[model samples]
Target: MRKIYITLMLVVGFSAVGIAQEINWLTLEEAVKLQKKNPKKIMMDMYTNWCGPCKMLDKNTFQNKDVADYVNKYFYAVKFNAEGNDVVNFNGKTYTNPNYNPAKANNRNSGHELARYFSVRSYPTIIYLAEDGSLLAPVIGYQTPQQLELYLKLFKNNDHAAFKTQQDFQAYAQAFKPEFKN
Candidate 1:
């Protein structure tokens, strides 16, 4: 009985060591507030409902355990819909799509002006921002968990500030240490 009890305790403890929940994705407003307190970088998954790559990113990339753990620890993860209904308060004013046309057959809405402000031309443009809501860079494409991890660390470490051009950043990204190698 003593041996069984000890074995059970060890199993439970080991299980607890690597268990983690889903990504604690935040709203833009909440992200800003958390940033002020924690001073970490921001990773925004700018998405739309009709986007295929956006869904893929959510299902495969954001759902991965390593990705979730790293993002939750080092960045304020934000899921911002390009055509969302929530009013965004930024730069001293609120922004929303006042001219959204619901009658159109396409999935277009009068997208949130903030999306336009950031010049997001694609559905799943991942925007990395500073703690103060300033734009760092917008990565436009579908990134697997491993691919996203490199960019996350690069921006988190402020390596982007070292680059003089996109070519320089591309060189750094090519040499980044990915999380899945372990």
Candidate 2:
């Protein structure tokens, strides 16, 4: 009986440790608010329910300890559903897709005005915004943990504005290495 009790205590202790290490995800409002106080850029993972790559990003890249640590440190991380009931307030107005028909299930939304505002043409678009609520850039598609790190650093350091062309970005990326470990 003592051996069994010890085993149970060990299991409970390890479970608590694992839960404590989990990433703390912030809501859109909370993230925006934090950005205002902390002076960090916003990195929003704009995802749709039907997006496969979005799920992969959540499971793979975002799950990596390095990626999580970097994002938690430098960004006001936000996960926004491209088709959801949440009303977003930006630039003195509220935006929502009241016409969203989730029943169709063919990867269609009621047409979020915010998505249109950002010109988001695809699923899983990662939108980066400056600390002052200015548009930075929206990158669409899947990116590995390492690849995502480059953009995180790029926008965090205001390098996006310096590199006006893809060639310039490529050159910079080639020469870049993370100054601090995640």
Candidate 3:
């Protein structure tokens, strides 16, 4: 009976550990507020409900333990619906989806003003923002765990500061050895 109790406790503890290894995503407002208290680069997964690649990114790259841990540790993760009706206040501007159609919520409704402000033309654009909430870059498309890991580390380490030209980024990409597996 004593051995069974100890084994059960160990199993429960291990299960809890597994459950805890996920990205702690926050709302845009929450992330912005938190940055004021504890500054960290913000990573926004700007996606629409109708995007197929966006769904794949959520299931594959974002779900990877290594990717989630690294992003959670170095950046305040935000999952923003680019077509949603939520009003976002950033950099002294209020953005909203004024043309959002409730009847076609799942379809490609008009994008939010925030998405247009950032010039996000594609779905699943991961927008990286500075600690002060300024735009760093917008990485468009679906990336595997290995592919996304490179950008995560590059921006987190501020390695992009050294790039003087497009060639410089290309060189860095060529030399990058992705350590994360899909």
- Tell me the whole-model lDDT of each prediction, alpha carbons only: 0.83, 0.80, 0.92
Residue-by-residue lDDT tens digits, candidate 1, 1-182: 99999999988996887444478988888888887788888888888877899989888788778888888889888898887666788778788877766563247666778789889989799999997889999999999888888888888888888899979978987887786422
After superposition, candidate 1 runs with Cα above 4 Å error: 1-21, 101-106
Best by TM-score: 3
Model 2 scores worst on lDDT over the 10 consecutive residues at 17-26
Error of 3 at 162 (Å): 0.7
TM-score of each: 0.83, 0.82, 0.89
Residues 32-134 of candidate 3 have per-residue lDDT tens digits of 9999999999999999999999999998889888999899899999999999999988888889999999998899999899999999989999999999999
How many clashes in each structure? Answer: 0, 2, 0
The lDDT of model 3 is 0.92
Error of 3 at 52 (Å): 0.3
Q: Which regions in candidate 3 have their CA more than 4 angstroms from the true location?
A: 1-20
Q: Give the TM-score of candidate 1.
A: 0.83
